[model samples]
Target: MRMFDVCIIGGGPAGLKAAIAAGSQGLSVVLMDDADHLGGQLVKQTHMFFGSEQQRAGARGVNIAKELVEQVTSLVNVEVVLCTTALGLYDDLVLTYETEGSYRKLSAKKFIVATGASERMLTFPGNDLPGVYGAGAVQTLMNVYGVKPGNRVLMVGAGNIGLIVSYQLLQAGVEVIAIVEGGPSIGGYLVHASKVRRAGVPILTSHTIKEAVGVNCVEGAIVCELDSQWQPKSGTEQRIDADVICLAVGLSPLTDILWQAECEMVFVPELGGNVAYRDSTMCTSKPHIYVAGDVAGVEEASSAMVEGELAGLCAAKSLGVSGAHLTLQITSARSQLEELRSGPVGDKIRAGLLQAHR
Candidate 1:
């Protein structure tokens, strides 16, 4: 088994940044991602990011992923492994992964689990139908594979993912029948909702899918208005024609490995789901184990990257790695993360973080 100073799992923005940070400190680092590509959900994000200049604001997510991959690959001390899956966490910080039909084991002094999050699926009639797809799946199909998800679609969430994917569908020449949200108010940014609305897609608040009507696949959908208690009201059901039913209900962190490793976990619905409990430095309950990105909690990719930088720098510093600017780098990263998590948009996240601290 080859030993490394840091083994970063899931080569998305967080893992890639962590590898670069640790490697820059002259630490031996190994970065692994399951996909043939390095970026997690970043590859499918075609929209410009929102943040300050340091967060690569205005840059497309695809471009940011490309830049991060290039930076990590150029670092001599970091080994990049694509098409690799980190299967399990074992005693002594050992990780096992499968690649090229062979299982490999490696041990590291520290680990950064940035496994990201999985899209939540809605339970409803005909949900498992062929034409029913997760919002992220639709994005991957259209953005990454260049394949149209469907010609006519009904979006079943008003969150950021649903709104953005609806707009992207329109850009792809797909017709969006309507966006149905269970909440009284739209969950995503008003700007995004406005963009979709200007394009003629109706944003129906306090509405939800009664059923994805179909036999072999989704051929249409039945939506109904919700009462104050969130139950579908009687006599308000409307049927619409749509070939695709895209569900963007929410997401949950991918923290099974953290559970296997016995890291302290907390359930934060705002952060998506159960995530590893980490301190300000992003260190989890396990001293040598750290977490960032969606695995820490389902925040944006920019914040995930900043969190990765904090973890990587702190991990290096904890290992007695000396650098004149180490302290400053860590401070700046933490500040940037705080700034990103500020504003009314981050109120839930702030509440979640506070709950975790408690």
Candidate 2:
């Protein structure tokens, strides 16, 4: 058994920020990630972010991850453990994790869960085919592994992920036949949607994939137009030829640890899926267990980073580590969050947060 002042159960944008915040206060911190490297999904994002200079808006996500990793590694009070999977959060506040087939137990005064979210899968005929992939998987293959997903791709969903990945595919020399969305309009930023459009890709709103046609792999897709109620319209089915069918429908919060801890959970479709009910400080119903990033609610990386810092500051303060500097930092993080969640773009997140906090 081992102990620390703080144990952060992820190494993504949120987890890394939390570790920096908590460890800078001279508290012992352990940051664990199942992958061999940190940065989580940030490592796969090649596109420049959108936000203020403080959030590194113009910087590419890969570069941002590198910078955050460098900062974290310099913190002597923080322990970075990779290839470690957190098994459960016990009632006694002890966390069990597995590393290299060995089980270990650790207890912390505060546990910050930035476990993040997984890409949501779409249901359709032949969805289990080999060439069918989630948007994240495609990003990892193309951006991280330097492997093209396919020669031509059919993208489902016009949300940011769908649009961004489509652009990335085009950059990789893969042909993006078209992007189909079940909704009435594109769900991502106009900037992203416009980028794909200028690249000669069509955006089909109120359209959805009805089935994937293939025997062993996705050879093509059958798509159709949708009515106002989102029901498929017969006789509108169109066959599109593509070697790959990518689904970027959405993401759902990974709150397994929260559920294990019995913290309050709510289903907020606007936020993605089931998420932990967290306060402004990112503290969940369970006092010692805090949540940030997608585990709390699905949002952009900028907001996740801010939430992580807020959670870390609050957790450290609860442990008697506080000063004027910490107070100011906390206030700044909250203000950034509010600003990020402002505007029409944040309407869905704002609605989701209202339900979670309720």
Candidate 3:
């Protein structure tokens, strides 16, 4: 069994920040992730981010993850375990995970769970077809592996993932016929929606995909308009020929490890599936364990990193590594995090925060 002052799980924007923050504070930290490499989903992202300059605004997620990895790897107190998936958390905060071909146990004096969210997928009649895939998968194939998911695609969901991916598909020389959104308005920001809109792809509102029409692979997408109650309207169905179908409805946190840890949690749909309600320190109902990033709730990479920094700082403090400095750092981080979680869009998520403490 390996031991550390803190174990930060998940190596995306959140876990990477936690590891860096804790190491900077003189805490021995371990970052465990499932991928063969670092960056997590950020590895699959090629576009720049949008936010205040402090959040690395306009920097590609790839560049941001590069800088983050560079910082963490240079720290003597921080260690990274790649190609490892944390399976469960046991008593004394023992982290059970598999790495390479072996299972290992790691114990931490304090723990920060920063495992991020996974892309949420929708199943249609032909969802099982070969060409039907999640936007994240498309990103993985195209952005990370440099392999095109398809030549022509029909995107379902005009949300950020869908729109941004449609634009990416265009960047990769693939054609996007149209994007469909079930909501009245495009599900993502107009900035992103308009980017693709100007490129000549139509954003269809109040629309739903009835099926991906094909026998083995998606040959086309069959779409229909929805009524006020989201029921399919009669005679509005249409088919747009395509070779691929991308689903980008949204994301939900991967919280199975939290479940195994038996952490007190709540299902707040707006926050993006099950999340632990934490105070400013990001500590969960289990005081020794803290939750941050999308696992705490879905927001954006900009805020998730700040939350992870705070969570790591707080966890180090709890375990007596500069516990006194925690207040100052936490104060600064919380202010920034609130900024990211504020605004009109943030307000909707703020109201969805589960206030019932366990």
Question: Where does candidate 3 stray beyond 4 Å?
Answer: 323-326, 354-358
lDDT of 1 by residue, 182-286 (tens): 999999989999999999999999999999898899999999999999999999999999999999998899998999899988888878889888887788888
Error of model 3, residue 229, in angstroms: 1.1
Model 3 whole-model lDDT (C-alpha atoms): 0.86
Clashes of 2: 0
Could you say which candidate leads in lDDT?
A: 2
Model 1, position 43, has a per-residue lDDT of: 90
Query: What is the model-wide C-alpha lDDT for candidate 1?
Result: 0.90
lDDT of 3 by residue, 45-154 (tens): 78889877878989999999999999999999898888888887876768888877888888888888888888887877988999998999999999998999989889
Candidate 3 Cα deviation (angstroms), residue 161: 0.9
lDDT of each: 0.90, 0.93, 0.86
lDDT of 3 at 15: 92
Clashes of each: 0, 0, 0
What's each prediction's TM-score? 0.98, 0.98, 0.97
